[model samples]
Target: MAALAATDSADLEKLLLEVCSSPSWAADVAASRPWSDRGALLAANAAAMARLTTADLADAMAGHARIGSPKAGDATSEREQAGIQGVDRALLDELHGANAAYEAKFGHVFLICATGRTAATMLAALRERFPNDPATEAEIVRGELRKINDIRLGRLLDEPS
Candidate 1:
């Protein structure tokens, strides 16, 4: 993977395609090029995510529905478990409602970094963000995407070291 980063743009693009899905476009952008510095890589990632259109953002969100609190024996669930707490039945229902409402308003699924957050906290964020206009909301989405990317990348790099 490091070798591919030093290759040409085409190879880099291919490597990115392999490493990240539509939902994780920021990671794809980050992985595509070898960065001289981590800051540059993170900046590029933020820019790439910010450039996504609403439809693109929505597509990304749809691709990541299962990224919430991890269930036992589920990697995603486990990842989420560290971030999400107090996700009882009532809170889940509220989250569902907030998700639906946010999607309805923006035509995209709500995007957030669920790590280390309670269901109530997530719900509050969703409700607060619901009032943003498209332009404002896109920035918010990009911020959330960055946070999620950071968490995922940390996990990826921490494997069995």
Candidate 2:
């Protein structure tokens, strides 16, 4: 927390963008710095998430890869989506189709906190959320983004100062 608070503004915003892709979110978190603790930082994250416009949230979601298809070089997505790795090919194909259906329905990638969750669980969630109206899905997306950001923030703080 101390190290992040002490980081220069541009660098700090860059780091925060890794946690959340939205420039507005990164800037908001950066500007609200000097966090007293991890909890305070998370609170700021939640507050910033709440302030995001629909378009801003879409921008943030754009940073994330579709579930079951973690980008090749993205360690964060690879680690978070580990459950999808080495799974049955049939299951993977199913997940891929579901991902397409989700994107078609929501007009954005399906966002979920995949850390500690199985591919099956994520698939179930995607199917369940498939029926939601845009407004409800957007709200759920914000919550999922919050969870992903919290996990990434924890990892960032764990890095050597």
Candidate 3:
């Protein structure tokens, strides 16, 4: 916590941006630094995420690849969504179609914290959320984004140990 709190501004922003890709979110989290512990830092991240405007949320969502592709997204996404790869072909195809419908409806990728979730479970979730209203779906996306951030932040802070 001390090391992250004491990091230089440029480095900190870069790191935070890698986690969520929203400039404002990163900036806000960075601004709220000097956290006393991991819990405090995580709280700052959640608060910053909550403060995001719709546009900012979209900007962060842009950083993620569409779910269920043959490939996972960026390196971090690759690790977080590792379970989606090498699944049954039928399942993968279904996910691809669901992703298309989701993007067509929401104008953004279907964001989920894929860590620890099996492909079937994620696919089921995607199907379930397909009928959600925009406002509700946005809330779901925000929650998923928060989960991903929490995991990534843990990784970021754990690096030195």
Candidate 4:
């Protein structure tokens, strides 16, 4: 969307603010050099996410819940639909339980690369990763966030309307 590139800095700022609630992070993303491709744009966004402190990461997580496969009627919900797929109801229930337990243990939401993964697979991953120490989990969470950004940037850079 080169037209988006042509947008003024203030408009760009507003757009990013809509995408991410963190003011400092949004400002940094808006001030970044114009990207020629989706990959570059996503890389920059991921780098910014990686730089956030643990508390900041928690705030970002609060902005996003699990990517729901069948999106509800809301912007943020639709955004989450990108990474969701239908799965067995039982598996979904188990995943929800696991997610709650994981959050209680880690003091942060469970994060995973959800693109193309089924609920069962994601649940298995969550269970497997539950044993990692906080430092290790933080790195994993950053990687998952980068993957999500990559998906979002691809959508953003699609051919203009």
Candidate 5:
């Protein structure tokens, strides 16, 4: 927290963007800096996230890789989607099909905080959310994004020893 609170504006913005792809969100969070603890930083994150417009949320969601197809070299995505790493090929194909259906329905990748969740669990969520109307799904996406952002922020402030 102290390190981030003391980082320069540009550096801070860059770091926050890694946590959330939305420029407005990063700026909003960076502006509320000098946080004294994790709770304060997360509160700031939640507030900024709540203020995001539809377009802003879209921009934020753009940062995440689709669940089954983690980007080749993105450590963040790889780590967060670790549950799918060594799963069977049949399950992977099923995940791919489910991802396509979800995307077609929502017009965006299914977003979930996959850090500690299994691939099967994520697949089930995609199926569950597939039936939701766009507005409700958008809110759910926002909530998932909020969880992801909170985890990323904690990672940013609390480096491993």
Candidate 6:
């Protein structure tokens, strides 16, 4: 909250986009600057995301890194998927295969919060979700994107000086 309040508008927009790569969401939040606190910021984010068009959601989803593939995304994503780091080669292979299967079915990267989940857990979830139809999967994707945005937003404010 303090950090956002102190940041310039352009930088805030960039930061918001980094958290959730939806231009509409980032612009709306940037326009509502000087948030009273983190709660208000979060509420704004949730509302903006709720109102997101399919394109916006797709834009946000496109920003995510695949689970167990840290090299595929930014520093934030690398950190977010830290739990998958240092896992055994077999688990990494499984996660890669699962990611490929998920992408084949969904036509996009499998995105989750991945803040504190292991490769095995993520793989299990990916497999568990394979049977879901597109509509169901989209809803799940929306929920996961929201979680990822929330975690990223918290981290933006939590960064050390």
Query: Which parts of model 2 are misplaced by more than 4 Å?
Result: none
lDDT of 1 by residue, 1-161 (tens): 34434657665554443323454474457454666555555665667676776666765565455323344665664656454544577777777777878878887767777777777777888888888998898888768866775565445434443
Q: Is candidate 2 or candidate 3 better by lDDT?
A: 2
Order by TM-score, highest first: 2, 5, 3, 6, 4, 1
lDDT of 4 by residue, 10-78 (tens): 877776655555566666776675877666677678778877887767766665665333336655445
Error of 2 at 9 (Å): 0.2
Ranked by TM-score, the better of candidates 1 and 5 is: 5
45-150 per-residue lDDT for model 5 (tens digits)? 9999999999999999999999999998999999999999889999999999999988887888999999999999999998988889999988898899999999
> What are the lDDT figures for the candidates, one per model?
0.63, 0.93, 0.88, 0.69, 0.91, 0.83
Report the C-alpha lDDT of model 2 over 8-53, residue by residue, as the tens digit: 9989988888889999999998888789999999999999999999
Which candidate leads in lDDT? 2
Q: Write the per-residue lDDT of candidate 6 for residues 1-161, one digit (tens) a residue.
A: 67678888888888888888889889987877678988888887787878888888889887777788776547877888998978999989989998898899988888877888888888889899989998898888888888888787888888884
Report the error of model 5 at residue 121, Å: 0.4
Writing each residue's lDDT as its tens digit, candidate 3 over 18-112 gives 89999999999999978989999999989998999999999899888777652433577677778886899999888889989988998889989
Colliding residue pairs in candidate 4: none
- Per-residue lDDT of 108 in model 4: 70
Candidate 6 minimal-lDDT segment of 10 residues: 69-78
Among residues 3 or more apart in sequence or in different chains, the pairs in candidate 5 whose N, CA or C atoms overlap within 3 Å are none
The per-residue C-alpha lDDT of model 5 at residue 155 equals 84
Q: What is the lDDT of residue 114 in candidate 3?
A: 89
Give me the runs in candidate 1 sitting further than 4 Å from their true place: 1-20, 23-32, 66-74, 81-86
* lDDT at position 71, candidate 5: 92
Off by more than 4 A, model 4? 67-71, 75-86, 159-161
* TM-score for all models, in order of appearance: 0.71, 0.98, 0.95, 0.82, 0.97, 0.91
| Candidate number of the best TM-score | 2
Q: Least accurate stretch of 10 residues (summed lDDT) in model 3?
A: 65-74
